[model samples]
Target chain A: MTGSSVLFDAPGPKARRNSLITSIVGGALIVAGVVWMAMTLAAPRESGGITLPGMFDESRWDIFADPELWGFIWNGVIGTLRAAAVAAVFALILGVVFSLLRSSRLKWVRYPTAVVIEFFRGMPVLLMMLFILLVFSTGSYWAVVSALAVYNGALIGEALRAGLAALPRGQREAGLSLGMRELQTKLLIEFPQAFRQMLPIIVAQLVVLLKDTSLGYIVGYPELLRATMNNLSSYYGNRYLFPLFVVTFLIYLTMNLLLSWLARSLARRRNSGGGGRGRRNAGGDADVSPDQAILVAEASAAARRSTST
Target chain B: MDVVIDNLPLYLQGFGVTLLLLAVGGVGALVIGVLIATMRIAPVASLRWFATVYTEIIRNTPLTLVFIFCAFVLPYLGADIPYLVSAFIALGVYTSPFVAEALRSGINGVPVGQAEAARSIGLGFGQSVSLVIFPQAFRMTIPPLINVFIALTKNTSVAGGFFVAELFATGRTLANANGSAVIPILLGVAFFYLLITVPLGLFAGRLEAKWAVAR
Candidate 1:
């Protein structure tokens, strides 16, 4: 039952045999694909194949050991991280503001905030980057950061709103019963609890915001991808593009995986009753389970009426 | 603003290219995604592993790398596919994992009791999934599927990096032609994208509402 799919019962003897046959067939298909790709790459250069293994050549590989190239690549990575950090901060601030506005009592405030979120969510981050860059006269740094900030700000806002909406109405009633003002009750009681639920979702959106920094390359922002491309052309000409692209891809994969691991570990610690040190002492919402945290995040994203690119 | 009107035809062409990629890529992703989702749930351990690996790798890698691979790696390997074909392939392959994950979640949401009941009626594994599970799953899938499609539509802009004359590229050219009017040109491009995404987004919301009550 532990390994079983939710939709299937355990397999019987005959089903085991069928599974073996399918696995063999699947393995063959994968091998065939790899063989085809290798043959294509190993073909003659005049006939459009690289014909040379310049990518694996010691000379080309040595370029990576060069201090100048390494320095440039490091700078690009820092640029990407810096932009993402700034954008995440801005997005969180904006998300909190809009989500608060969304639940506002006034129609003018609520409706207009909804419209802005919808618009930002629908527009591509790349388009937003271009628009912001041109319209605001901000350089590439702000352009990239602002675009990511606005787009993700909308997503985080929706997630936070959903978190608030999912809370038991009695919590609000209890706060009011204590003679607290509505705004005070919300500010002191509601938002803190909602935020505890929203943390995982915010982290997920932050991963997305990080990946989007690669788009900064299109505008010559000297991010990781752009820096790698520059190094590729400068050092080995266009011939070594594939290897460099693979390297860049792996770096991104590693970063995203680290973020995911952080999410998982945080969830684990909370679920194990480790009394995770940062567990908020406020509002007695201290028992926010990790599973419930993720579920609310996903549900909120699903419940979001607005769509994003 | 006048620049937008003057270059309306150019913008329209770019818009057409974006739609073309979206239509073709959407179909390709749906087919592959369903196949991968089937593989994921299949009783074969190796096949399930394969599907898991594929999804993990593709979803983690950025779409830009996929585009670069299609644009350059294929040529390096002695294939000379057209720019549009390569771009479409990249878009389809990059997006399929997301589509598959959505469909898989949809599949999960259907009760095990439903599948067991289907099997009791003498349906095979494939038949149960296709006839009973998928129909129910797709309804649950529509909203998330729409989100994936919207992401795909926006991602098509990356084709501009590889020299496909899509909306963003059109905007770039317009900006270059009238440097001071960059604002209008970008506004026009963003408007064109909204023309496609905004309506589809609204429709998805309506559909989600329609389906929520049924669920």
Candidate 2:
């Protein structure tokens, strides 16, 4: 509160408390409405001549238990994971490569990489998928991987660029003063710092990409969604909702948990190792003094005052 | 490639269906998205729980599964919703969670002090949100919202599986009818999609840049 935030002007303690209450109240009302509606409303019924009990099935937990479904799902999951993982690797490589290119003294390599990154970053993931699908058809696994790699690779470029920008100008000057090559400055000093800062955001984007593998089903690839469709058509058409809800919860929960854990571990290591600027900032003085915090809040509030004509 | 030109009229029909589905589903999802966003951010404990469950349940599932469930199920209870409406319902619901997340994040981006100032100006609780917070939120949220919209537009191809006859279906139909030309036909479909998504992406970028400069 002592310093100005990027957004809103600051407020006094009472004002902050009041707004927190309104946020709480507004959120509460929404939850209440959803519950009232869901409980009062009936589960949607199937339109066919027959009705099935609308509940999640456990017996077909064996469907997952089945080697065939398991193989397919496993393969699908592996393919998805491998694609995302490989793409992530490629993205990292590409991001680092592009950052070095831009940071280099020569303009030749820098501008092309910049343009390529911007074009792909500006387009949607689906467009990338479609463009790749055109070459690969339904059977080409490499095509999907390539498409994901290139597009995500582009995004990593931007993340790296931003991360580099976050570094203080003094660091770059010090590296140059020490007679380091531009590449040495970037790789030895700049990148390690930027990568640490950008890791959380990059991870979040990767999770989105992981979820996006399901989009492959549109091109007739037999991924998890395809498996779900196969099961629904063969066994329990009328009970699609419950089964869908369960399967989605299970699969996504496990994957997201794993990803989150990896992210946490990475963050933890960086913090413990005293690897970057964050470590310097992590000293005991990092704690905000309440009085100064209040003053900052007051100052922040003062900015909110609009001077009317 | 030859198939596309020969069947130009039919492919145009398919493009029309694709556009219609996106428009209807996009609008429907926007309503559902806004509602769920409010729910997720609600103040009540129990109420917030419901929104959490909804987002958790919906966001995790594959969009394709939801679409299939809508297509294959719900017929046993004496209801026969049209394939288009069914597709819309599933896609709309699937996209809503994303939109909700985008919006909630955007709204959260607005500084809390703004809310305080609005209240000090004598705006009531809801008034502060609807008038002060949301305008800023909408401005911030446009970029992500555009990204979601582009994804949703592409996802409509999923309904092609249920035989809804959208652009993808038309491409597939053309592929089937004029064998070995799937590549060009899909390229045709992709062309239509790019024609739509690119402009929208640029528009959203403009909106974001404008808001960024404003703030």
Best by TM-score: 1
After best superposition, candidate 1 residue B140: deviation in angstroms? 1.7
Off by over 4 Å in 1: A1-9, A35-51, A54-60, A266-309, B111-135, B213-215
- The B-chain TM-score of model 2 reads 0.89
**Fnat per model, in the order shown:** 0.37, 0.10
Give the TM-score (vs. native) of candidate 1. 0.87
> Would you estimate the TM-scores of all the predictions?
0.87, 0.71
Q: Encode model 2's per-residue lDDT on B32-77: one tens digit a residue.
A: 9888877666433454566677876666555655765687655433
lDDT of 2 by residue, A266-290 (tens): 7577557755454344333314322
lDDT of each prediction vs. the true structure? 0.76, 0.62
Which residue pairs of candidate 1 clash? none
